[model samples]
Target: MSGVITGERRSADTHSARSGGGAFVPEATPLDDARAQLAVATGLLGYSDGLHAMLATPRRELTVAVPLRADDGSTMLFTGYRVQHNFSRGPAKGGLRYSPGVNLDEVRALAMWMTWKCALLDVPYGGAKGGVAIDPRLHSKAELERVTRRYTSEILPIIGPERDIPAPDVGTDEQTMAWMMDTYSVNTGYTVPGIVTGKPISLGGSQGRASATSRGVTHIALAALKHRGISASRASAAVQGFGKVGRDTARFLHQAGLRVLGISDQYGAIHNAGGLDIERLCAFVDETGTVMGFPGAEPLDRDLLLELDVDLLVPAAVEGVLHEGNATRVTAPVIVEGANGPTSPAAARIFADRGQLVVPDILANAGGVIVSYFEWVQANQAYWWNAAEVEAKLEERMLSAWQQVVDYATQRTLSLRTAATVLAVERVAEAHRLRGLYP
Candidate 1:
């Protein structure tokens, strides 16, 4: 484990080219924070260094070049990545992100986190993540489809319904999954709906799959608020992202009686101390493509939204938004991470010291994967579940996991993140031990 850690540090330094010694000290990345969290869990479990090393490393990874032909006949190239961090428990499962910032390291971290999240939730799957470094917003519908198909085709050999399943994430959506499914199906000469989740409902997507993450986040947020003795009607929240996860999260939180005071997207943020009309705000975004200039709220500095003095803060945006610089200024007594790795190690430690109730992303956002599991099951059986049944099952699993994490945290005096990760690591390690190494 020490050797592995040292090697990672050296790799980080090598990537840096800012120092006189050709070192550009980069900021701590999601992978750095992920390994740190795993270290804590492995230490708590008293695992051997060999096992620790295995848990820290990705099982397989692939990088590909994605070339695109624009409508005007221009040529562009993008890098794409697919990482399967672990498959000890079952098939690898994670999302396919399309963003300008997508990189191998970020995908690795997300895949690793998916491993723990699946294990923690008792989902029969390991962890995997895929991404293409192109901004979906900057491309046309046809261009995005070409990129998705090209990227999917590039990685088709490694992905399948029974191997790795890719869903939507970040800049991608159900339409993206549809493209991936079509590309993979065309190559295989048949439909393989199970190859991906979060597809359009007509194509075997589960009834409640689209809003699973947000619904899951809200469920855990309400539970966290209650655990902290905050009532939904009296509680106020600020959501820091307005994408796939954040938009629905804000709406659901508002629906559940939380005064959603602020909402932000990459362009800007808006605030209404009296609780913004989420429906109207969502409509405004639909019409104008941004949360800024909503008639019902005042414009706010995007960064300041995180520092708002709300009862609960939900950072559903990108990674490292709430770092050391802004963690202390964050006034929300309870934070439910709606995005993966939204809180950094330093920020997590600060929150722990302050006795803040921070719900880790793995637990808070497991709803998507949980429902993804359901969608996969349905696809395999050729029998789909209704929305009510899906939502009920999702809530049952989410709350059960929440109780287990809370109990473990209380018994061991560990933060929720540590407790959840320790439990998950223990489960995955036990599975590995039982399976034994391949000859």
Candidate 2:
């Protein structure tokens, strides 16, 4: 495990050069954070060194060169990766991201998180993540399709409906999944809609799959508020990162009666003490491509969104946003993490010391995977579920998991993150022990 961790760190550092015009963004080491998290859980379970090392290392990983023929009759090369962190529970499942900062360590970290997330939700899937270090925003539709197909083909041996499934992430969306599914199907001489989730609804995708994560966040946020004796109508929130997760999170929070006082995106952030209209703000983003200058709010520094004096704060954009530098200034009593690793270990400790309730990402954002499981079942059974049925099941599963975590935390006097990780690690370790050593 030490050798693997050291290799990943070297790989990340070797490939740390900035791509195109994107500046080098320094952030916390996700791989280290992941290892630290595993250490805590292993300590709690009293696991042996061998077992701890086994859980820390990934089951399998692949790095490939994705060659793309540009529209201008030129060739371009990009590095891509797929890491299957664990598969003791079931098939591996995670997202494929495209960004300038994509690296092996980040994917490894994300894959590890997915393992715990599936166990926490009892979703019957392990963890895997794939990524390509190319900015989709700088590429054309045709270029992205070519890259997706080539990348899928390169790692085709490991991915399938029953093996490892890939879904959308930061820079990938429904179209990207559609391309991967089509490419895999073409090679196999038949359609394989189950190869990926978050595909177009017409292509065997679940009705509520797209917004599942945001909906799950809302469910947990509301539950946290209730546990704190706060009413949703009187509550207020500030959301950071108004992208896929953030935008929908804001809308759902507003719909649930929380006054969304501030919302931020990559361009900038907007605020209104009296609560801005979410519907119009969404429409404005759709038209102008950002929330920078929405008609109903005033502009403020993006970092200020984290310190807003609201009942709830959601960091739905990127990782390491809530680090030691700003964690002490946070005023929100409850934080529902919509993004993976949004709160660093140091910041989490700060929040814990301050008596803030920090909902772990694995528990808060399990809705997407829950519905992905439903979609996979529907695909295998050749039957689909309606939106209402899907949403109801998602809500039920999310709330059940939430209650389990809360109870465990309360009983052991542990933080929610520690409780959730401990529960998940125990489940996975039990499965591994039952399966025994396979030659």
Candidate 3:
């Protein structure tokens, strides 16, 4: 959705599977942002304290010790978590991330976002997230496979096609989903392709699944440009975190006629005022593993990418990249968050004060889950769709949700983020109210 309300205020606050050991860890910044956003939405809904508490708390959580025998015959223990934030709408759905910083609080926050994302997109799934606190980069393929299998086995009791389905997220990818799917199928004594999304196409993954998020972001970005009476050909953009989402987002933006002037990876960034050739840049990254030295573009600082003078800025890399320190420097008029929790509460407020139209990650990056929903439906029916069919449906669905959020915002005079959050929370709250609590 797209219009605006003059007044509204807020606060801020803001996963997974596989095999476990646990130690208590405090809440992280992203979780705090997630909660703050929730508070704003619930207050707007006029929900009671009891209802707010119920909405804030997770429906279930599992922490496990995942032990892996290394390639050198050494054993390492990692902590993993699977949190289901809510299931009043349907089964839990989210991604499995493998990162050294994974923690329960992060998982909780992500799961909570997934809940709203799914609800906002009208997907028949709640929010869930899983993560293992291990650095995938430090592990060999053999070692990573073992970790994925063991983690899947450890959380097998809580995950299933009809219960909680998993997909790929940060520090993980299609191969990770393949391992997870294989492990789950092995335990069930039968193949279950529906247990996961983002798997290989040969294994029942949806067509266009890999680029769904970027496509969705591009869809929204284009819509935002139109909302501002700007044409894509005249628009310029800078995308940070040139990984899965950022890479494709830049490419699609360029394809859609936007001057993609800046692109970044973990190592560094590159910029060309005339617009970088995304295809060649992708080839360079594919060959060199980073955007650090693309010959067509000049080197730029990674942090400077977000502050570049552009019409659209996509933060697709990791959480907190747009925190309090740099939020004020961001010059992009439109931000379609491609990463979960990329903007902190303080930063979001700054954007609001500056009158920058910030499309929250929940609505901006929901294309992945929406496509995952399609993948799951296709798997259950064993009816795969053609790429053209998938893309058309995706564009239709994304634009529809954007309009809905825009309409809500315009009608209520709320920010796009607040409107999207309020609509999602209201739907979930309605589902819960109808289901009612059992004694």
Candidate 4:
């Protein structure tokens, strides 16, 4: 099957650089942890300290005050941010999320992850991310549309087909992207589909892009299973989130012969020894707004899904699902990260110590950006590929990337997470050295 590797793992490390108190800054938020991640990776990748310091930070961050007109008779003000982590390679690209916990730090981290993610797949993009601190589920569609359109206008100066592009993150979707594309086009006097991806198919979005992240996670999980000589058809799996990524990933794996044992959403979790009816579970979540009341499965506390007995565990929900607190209790032999920064670096090491294989988010969930790049290319050319072509291309890219990371990890005697960081950081450093810093 041509399982040869591209190179050795880079050896990303612990955060030894001094913060204010010379104590390691906890890898809590995305930006704080992204800097720490780069610091560790720079050491392992052997970048010059100057370059390390420069790369440890983002290029720019813009925070806008989005004053929204609620469906009710009141006006509410929300804070939004867009952070372009690095654009040495190309225009910045990432998703814009909405959540009460969204912040500058988290946006920074996700943008940084985008950089490595692009580098890892050799895609022609840098990292960027935006977020707003609002509980989007609490609002009506009209209110969300207003907020999205306004947010798009506020960030319009830095966004376009050739500048930064936004996609769906947490609390966002094709409709949101449709609003963004429409808003941007209205400002420019033309339709520009490339300004955003993950939009409705009728609005020039790729057919499979919405499920790309979940598909990519499925690809990585199967690769891990194949690498360990475990037949996926005989394997059991658990998913820690029931959002788009988690839900679709479960359905894909189930269709591929894996037994999906448990699943969770924000509300709660459900489990069955044989396997949950993924299609049924999806329908239940669709109608009920959560997986708590599914007919055929028993419920578990949300936190306990991480330690479930399974062959592969996919954390597709929020960050920090596998942290210092729960790393020791995790039972899966492999963890395929579907969310950025799902596992703390130290916690990853603990998993490795226990002989577990972790496919980091950068490598595993890269299907979204790969297809986003396709959308960008199409937008620029004013031509679009069919759904079959897009799916074929996505499968090819993610499968090849998985083999590359796996090969590097095999050759370097390192974890896939370390190898992924090392490969990505080295490529980025080379790009930086070639471009040089401008005066």
lDDT for model 2, please: 0.89
Ten contiguous residues minimizing lDDT sum, candidate 4: 4-13
Reference-based lDDT, residue 84, model 1: 97
Clash pairs (backbone) in predicted model 1: 16-24, 17-23, 17-24, 18-23, 18-24, 19-23
* CA lDDT, every model vs. true structure: 0.90, 0.89, 0.89, 0.84
Residue-level lDDT of model 1, residues 78-186, one tens digit each, is: 8899999998999999999887677888899999999999999999999999988876777799989998999999998899998999999988889999999999999
Tens-digit per-residue lDDT, 29-134, candidate 4: 4455667777777888777889987776788889998887777667888889999988888889999998877777778888889999999999988889998887
C-alpha TM-score for every candidate: 0.94, 0.94, 0.93, 0.92
Where model 2 places Cα greater than 4 Å from the true spot, the runs are: 1-27
Instruction: Show where candidate 4 strays beyond 4 Å.
Output: 1-27
| Rank by lDDT (best first) | 1, 2, 3, 4
Looking at model 4, the pairs that clash are 30-109, 31-109
